[model samples]
Target: MKAEHQNLYQPHKGGTLCKMLFPVLLLTLFFPLGHAQSSMSPEFSIIKPRHSRLLKSALQRETSAFLLSDPWAPLENQGWRSCVESRNGPALPEKSEGYIQVFLDGGLNQQRMGICDAVAVAKILNATLVIPYLEVNPVWKDSSSFEDIYDVDHFIDVLKDDVSIVKELPEEYSWSTREYYATAIRDNRIKVAPVHASANWYLENVLPVLRSYGVAAISPFSHRLSFDNLPMDIQRLRCKVNFQALTFVPHIRTLGDALISRLRYPQDPLKVTAAGDKEMAGKFVVLHLRFDKDMAAHSACDFGGGKAEKLALAKYRQVIWQGRVLNSQFTDEELRSLGRCPMTPEEVGLLLAALGFDNSTRLYLASHKVYGGEARISTLRELFPLMEDKKNLASSEERSQIKGKASLLAAVDYYVGMHSDIFISASPGNMHNAMVGHRTYLNLKTIKPSMALMGQLFLNKNISWSDFQQSVVEGHQNRQGQIRLRKPKQSIYTYPAPDCMCQA
Candidate 1:
């Protein structure tokens, strides 16, 4: 598994300048209008003729700022809404002989986010209508603007059968997965392409489609795209579009709250819990260790070749496990799995005394080969007499997978969550756990620019896992030392039934 970096901000030199200026402009324009509204609801007075003109200018500026700030906000006071409502549905330009439409399949990620990115390019370039998946049903229903929307019911057939808009796609774009998504873009006469096409391949094959649709430039953030490889002609087209006259001067609206608002689902119960758990809700640091068994995708960067890959995985696993043991307060259940064997009985006795366990921290055994089929349970029972109880031995074996990969990972996560007091994760494979959860410590080896941006965004959310750990280590150290396991908030699971107590 490759290291994953989180990408929060789309890369744009111009966009960065726009972000810095927008807030100041909004603040300057908003204050007076808000004061006037509070002072007089329906009407207000301007002391002088010059003041009246200045007031009108302020109001116009305010309206523009509000529209940009919140596209979803009501635009009744904003003259732009009325302007749009009044304009007759403009006919498609003669040059717009074809179209390039996109439909997102799943939740926001590289794919949907990339498409959203195209919004800026399309607006600036006067490209053919590039509607986002969310905007299919326009919020304001005006006929002229609404005519651009085509019903997607027969979208697949249209892509496969339509000849007017599409041309043959590249061979690599003909894979089954590509065709599956291409169903939406294909025209009867032309073959629509997939997002997976390399930047160069897309520019070569899709430029004609853009020109046919009168689309000079497009935003394509939803895919792994780069302008570095575009053909010289396509670059010239973009330059031309940048200089072309605009029917409407482009305006970008930025809302800091928009992303958070989108995260709230309509069906969400919106539950909030009291701060502390019944028992010391032991901080379970999740360390995800992703070992890619498949050897197919390593042709490009084989510095040490296959030998390097194996070494990387082993080192990664060892580092994560050692970090967890050193940083966290672990129970006997966890220490037994650490594989740090004592050289002698005296050494083992000292280790047990240090742990405050009565010769019960099972001495790590060298002969044990749980990764292969060995009597790990029998070995454990012999080492720790407390496990002589048949029921106890059976339970231990059931909880710990001494052999298989899937089961081992599951057991590790479970044991940490159940018994540890702090957690740190190193895996980039399980995106939800690594990216979305309340993570406190992360052990990522690579620091891509996109990932750095994501880390900044992740910190904005107060409940992230890393934040939780920081609060505990800094503010709650005294509290943890005195902490005792409270009664389980819910019941623990038995052998035949799986545990539901840990469900998030």
Candidate 2:
């Protein structure tokens, strides 16, 4: 059986022709070609020609007993409501102190948090905010600006009452650029703002700069503001920015709506009656597969890729971080026991199967490139044959606007994930953190996976499928969309219970 599995994947070496035949061969091996075609929906049936499908039928048969009668039932939200109350907080000052400029660095979600913190910092210092600058992402090499991904006008208009915001600096402060600050440390440049700096820290360090030069430019400003000890109004303003202010541009939203429409009604329009349309409006689960190469390499845990894979990852780690991976000291077993390893595509597929999702579930994959390419994700495709992603669902013309732009693509995924009936991330990261908070704010259902429990379960090679399914179901009982109140030093973006929510 192992040899057959290895043989099934050998087409990847033969290039395009063999890639096209790979899925056909797998379909023939598992189900007859006609049966495969008839069983698949229009969307799944017409995935890119080169896309491959490989299934291990023995594993599927083992876990088929746990399939639920109603796996699409919505998770409840215990009467919690999103409420940003600043009635007792102080009002905005009549006159702004000066201008505050921030250059944010990181991916979409990290920069998103930085943007909110920039707004709060502006409010704290009573300064007018110049639009935060989004640095070019090093990994994706995307040069998309803030306006390219978000609705700038909407962002400005939504926060107009809370804090002052401007698209550009005034003529007097126009000379303040990122290059200017990098060349030399001017009086107005703040290059040393601490991570999670307190409001008082900003007042002392930045307010003086603002008063001295009438402006302050903060570079590398991701996570520069603290989450704790802020005033009630400041915290509420952060919540408002995250939940109400940030909206995607028109094109991204249009594409997102189109994708959502297709996911709900995948059949051809000519075959549909009104009743059939109602019945076919299916609910989808958006699985944010955060299993890219950077994550896999940085985890420093072996993924059964053999010695060559291990050597490649080690070299990658050295090149990326100069071999500073802190988890490298631990053995793979120790790391898995500590829940520090990233889950692979196959592992996450088994997780979904154990959680009662069957082959019929419409799984929308919200991800970038998986590490090992098509061969790596073959098991996941087999587990949920009805799965779809941006590339498969959107036409080349339809997705042209966001094709190579990572930030824009992420924004589209964010929009679609927001509209999904249920959202889950294979492993927790920035995207997962952002979605969990946003879904909680909207009272939508989101499954937070227990990484430690899952790690331990997969380690037990002799465990039965029934026992694994029961453990997963029991472990996740209280984790689905439950409100976790913010503790000291906890991010309001992730745990927005008392700060951003009100109990009914």
Candidate 3:
């Protein structure tokens, strides 16, 4: 049997198959020859693929007998209700000697994470946050303004008690840009910036700036705050910041409501009768297919589309992403097997299908204009033909309103993902990390990838589809949006646990 087809599992030492199987087989001797031969055919064969020793045992977990969902069914735990009930943020102090205010400026994901940090910093310093300046992502050239996407008025009103916030810098723009101190941008192997200073540094250095200049401007503030050994209250403030403060703007939200309504009744009787479709489809999974051009160029993976493609990606990676990677350091084969970069569409398709998602399963792909367009998408589409995107789901008129606005389109995907039945990501990228916090805050099911384990399995060509699927299924069965109470700063899956979950 081909490795890609069989249900064989890699041999983990001291095989756990029941010894009684042989004895049961003895009874089969009395049966018809046809029945016994059934096991000999390809379908029931137990042969492990060649060249495979057990890579770590696939995530070993028992099947859950009871459903772990709430009464609302798929809307099991929404953030609106779940978060409002959280005591995750510390009680507000009665008095403050002065206020620490900051201006946030970064790319979309950076700004999202920066909001979490800014709220934490505000609580840590007991400062009020000026409405952040949402900078256009230079790389993306998106034109949507912050107010156009998020409700600034609602954002301030909701968090007014926990931390004071204003829309835009309260004073002249020069006050923010001129008399401010900015933290040095930091980076590490994982792209998560390391802590630049201790709490004392904020108290002594950053605080004085607030005192000296009523407003302090913190550029590239995402991932700037560290959770290392901080006081419990400080950590809680971080959660409060992430869950409570960063509400979407009203414009994006109305569209979100429409999307949610569609999900709730995909086959409305009235609409269906008009459109010639009555089949109801609900509960989709979101794939943050982070394989757009920028990502591929940034990673420099170059999965070899002949000589020209390889050289182009190699050169592209060199141009941006700083000096984090170099083409000469790794080969095409090494890059693919090492899992050092994003998975190819074919690879993702194979992975999803092998893990039991039927080809007919509806996958809501949350992505921008994928780099290679339909050609790249067709790779995964062939495997899961029922795939849909914003283009497929929304009307031409609906899409035209946000046409050419990259950030608004992203907002569409973000909101849809937040409400999905299950959210699965390709890697620990921004989309995955942000949703981990967002969905986790809502107690929604998230299939967080264990990259190291996945890489080991993905690279092992000898593993059969059945074995690969079973291992993946068992490995991840326990991680159905289970709370990650405490984890390292770099680990994106548990990123929200510090702020979103309580002891209850």
Model 2 lDDT, full chain set: 0.80
Per-residue CA lDDT of candidate 1, range 65-135, in tens?
A: 11212211111221111011112322223453334444433221222233322422232223343333332
Best by TM-score: 2
Candidate 3: lDDT of 147? 76
How do the residues 185-245 of candidate 3 rate in per-residue lDDT, one tens digit apiece? 3221012223544466567666666666555555545556666756656665556655665
Across 209-271, the per-residue lDDT of candidate 2 in tens digits comes to 888889999987998898888888888899999998999999999899888888877775233
Candidates in order, TM-scores: namely 0.23, 0.86, 0.72
Per-model clash counts, in order, read: 24, 0, 5
Worst 10 residues of 2 by lDDT: 46-55
Q: Candidate 2 or 3, higher TM-score? A: 2
In candidate 2, list every pair of residues with a backbone clash.
none
Q: Give the TM-score of candidate 3.
A: 0.72
Question: Model 1 off-target regions past 4 Å?
Answer: 1-208, 211-223, 227-272, 275-282, 295-504
